[model samples]
Target: MGNINKDNLLYMAKYSAFNPYRMREREMGYTTSIGSSDALAKSLYCGMKAIATWDSDREKAPPTGGIFNLEFSPEGTLLVAACEKKSIQIFDPLTHERIHAVNGAHTDCVNCVKFLDARMFATCSDDTTIALWDVRNLKKKIRTLLGHSKWVKNIEFSVKDKLLVTSGLDGSIYTWDINSYTEYNLVYQRVFHTSSLMRCRLSPDARQMVLCTTGGLIVIIHDLNLATLAQDLHGFKPNLYRLMQMSHQMIPVAAMYDHLFDSKNRENRVEFVSDFPEGNDAEVVSALQVHPQGWSALSRNISHDDKSEWTCIHDIQPMESPCDKDTRDTSPVGRGRRTPSRRTRPRVYRVPRPMHPNPMATTHIQITRESERAAAGPSTSHQGGAPISPPQPSRLGLPGIQNDVWEAAITIKQHRLLQEMYNRGADVPSTSGYTPHQESPYTSDEEPAAKHFIRQNKNRLLYYIEETNEGKGFIKELCYSSDGRIVCSPFGRGMRLLALNSDCGELSGVAQDLSQPRLMVELGQSLGIHTDLVVSSKFSPRYHMLVTGCLEGKIVWYQPFSGESL
Candidate 1:
């Protein structure tokens, strides 16, 4: 790393392509790479400059609505996208050139494109139709799937059962057998029946699926199966007003995001800021994609104020179960554990000398000794020849022919006695005679039950990242690479290449704290690349290049780190 410098720029460019955090480590002065990163770093801070590229302004084509979604081939060679122009566009991912185009493939805008395999892909459109296409022949569709009544929103493929699941605006979830295109799709009906449904996505691990709707409602189907949605299973509702309105039959961890229905200051409510002007409803999470590792999710927020578009990385961590360490602490003042021992009681600490020493009280004590000379006799003195001082009564007020201690001696003694009793009470076990750490079904212990409740109900927050750009345009898309090193998100008309500014993690994508996202490159609109709002973008899973689509029918491919034309 130290050998590669400005003098050897050619060598650095040749080998640094595979380095995941090349620009990030160069700026941060740290890396998982070998040697000191600062030695190999550049002296001048020319960070994230827009790379110069030749983009023609007169490049105009037909059916120019915009790209709705982008999907990469399983082999990472071709890129296909759903377009609002009612066509399917395919491109060579290595270059920015369009290899083939399917015009008038759908009656309405294509909403989503998903590759089934290397040679096959599926697409859904606003015309309520799903088409299966073959890469060998891009001229026509292999099969046209027609079952949805309204606009189809999303398409999910289950590799285990070889099924294609799709959801639509008509409030229906259908699963088609990909093995047999002639078979009719099965509509699984249970708790999910709403026209407000926006999109549903299966988790990367395929263990569960989350459904996001227009009413700020996010329903999760746990242990997801085709028959799981049709089963009559009871759901567990947490303590959140208007957030857990379940159908009472489906097992859903439901939570609402709308402030109009939810309490203004609800504790532990995981929701995004809403900006939609719709009537008492907002699609807070405009874009949602689970991390490929399946531990967390990446969500893009919808905002009317373009600059306030926030992106968050939510991690799903399992809550810790009840443990004995909490009940094993030994502190006495304020602790749960109760060990009955007073080795350092008040007696261990001596009370201070009285503030006001009375000389007349001392003289009176000497005079009383002479008066009781005959009364004391020989038995007054102890066996060791030391005379004992009798306990004084509270009735002996100041100057009552007795020892008159001035610093409220009676009150001090009473306080010590009360403290001892309070200590004993704290050590006392429950009526069932079980220790606090011991489990007792009949005992009144709410702590253990509360812990179990929290374990089941709580969703641990991993990290949150927000965009504070006070400029125009919102982030309509976020593309996370399959290699799990970078997260590409669009800001305004431009696009930003962001990486998790945390520890080096190659295996788990979103497992670390991603609160602080570092931007490596900015392909700004002023750079003569994407001149319009970047509505959709995709990262080459194996390569370090990114392709973005804008509203103006202009497509730009960029190298994520150097911001160069691909």
Candidate 2:
């Protein structure tokens, strides 16, 4: 009877399991719904002719080339797109008119396009140099930036109008000066990854530049906009003490999606650690800059704390937290919380007993199993879960697992020191080593840096211009007047302008019938008028107006903000 039961159990197990191909189909739900693979295949076959004919319509591109780079002006009016094509284009978004076009722009495909101002723009290409174009006159190139030995992938402008940033496939980024027409002494040339860099962008204020490279890595060029510090350091300080001082107390506070565990889906684990020790403090930084080496958090001292306690509160996304192989939760870990498998002595940071009764600072560590294996190699996790392949730490002198643990200890010490100082009065000895304006020497600017910030009133503007309708059919551009007095948006197939804060909300309206409004820009009163420019994705910035230079070398400037005409 026992043997028969065993045989029957084996038979059932064998019948229930699926092959690799079937498993993939089941996991992806290949043909389970209307938008399934089967449906996609049918749609592709049905629209074969349309797809072939409209394939060159750069406005509507498929994911084969991926989203190389995207940029929108602060006013959200001008949009620049650089893709696999060796050209740069701009457009009047509201009227759906192509504004400027530069063909044969590069020997290889243009990787990035950035507007330097109304007349000038910069583009990087696979041919190893950045081309500065006089978009005002699309007939000639203004200047050719030659330095990078590999494909120049991205370019950006600094806030002070002093520098031009360009990153290339060589894993190096160079900063150049417009006036000198020569390479600046500053170069954030770090070989962060074995693979080539794909994209790079400057922080709104241009303080730092972030690069996304091959191997799914990101690198943050610290002090790129060091208004004061730029006069000092030539390269990274690599302060081990500072890195150690910031390893603990920093933990992942947000929620991420998990592919496994919950059959109904929508679950993730919290990964917390001290910010990556790349020699940055919170005072000079306001947010965690995600990069290939790791993410960064700013540690600014609170003004109210007479003790000058460090009170910087910043966070970075996609932290690197590889857990031990034996660390899975039997019971589910709720959103934003984790049930750590077990606490070990080595992983815990020992704090001074004077600070707290127990004294040991407990650092919470959690690692989620990725659906796709990491490219770096096999890594371990704590959840006695399925074995996962994670990128291994480079054998070459990089910080090891032990170093991370030690750094965690130092982070706890720094936090405790800051907490103690906060408790003490401003006149205390801890504040003796520092003066009110000793270390930092700068006044708060009237116009804060150009970057994302949490608005206290919530009545402010937020710029969001992601690829819309998926597969790049169109891009949505939005801009709300400073006081929300007016709102303009390019919705599906039309441009919508409304009186958001008007009393009657019946302010004159118009909808330009179009497939999509790809870009929007407001020159502000800086343009000497209270008018805005809306251009298509293919248009380029020229003179004071937005003009479209099409494939036939035709220039067309669509007038959408002409209220009198409407």
The TM-scores, one per candidate, come to 0.57, 0.35
lDDT of 1 by residue, 1-566 (tens): 65545535543443243445666666887544432222122211112333322122434446546666788887789988777778887877776567777889898778789887899999998677788899999788887776555567688887755767787655456676666532343322223343334566776656656665433345544445654443322221221212212111111223222221222322222222212221112233556676676655666654322335556555442233365233122232222422212112111111111123333221111122111111111221111222222222233222221121222234335435544544344443447685534443533322221222111122323434455342232226676766554566765576665555322234254345334333232213223466666677777666655667776656666653444433
Looking at model 2, residue 247 earns an lDDT score of 30
Q: Which pairs of residues collide in model 1?
A: 233-249
What TM-score would you give candidate 2 relative to the actual structure?
0.35
Residue range with the least summed lDDT across 10 consecutive positions in model 2: 361-370
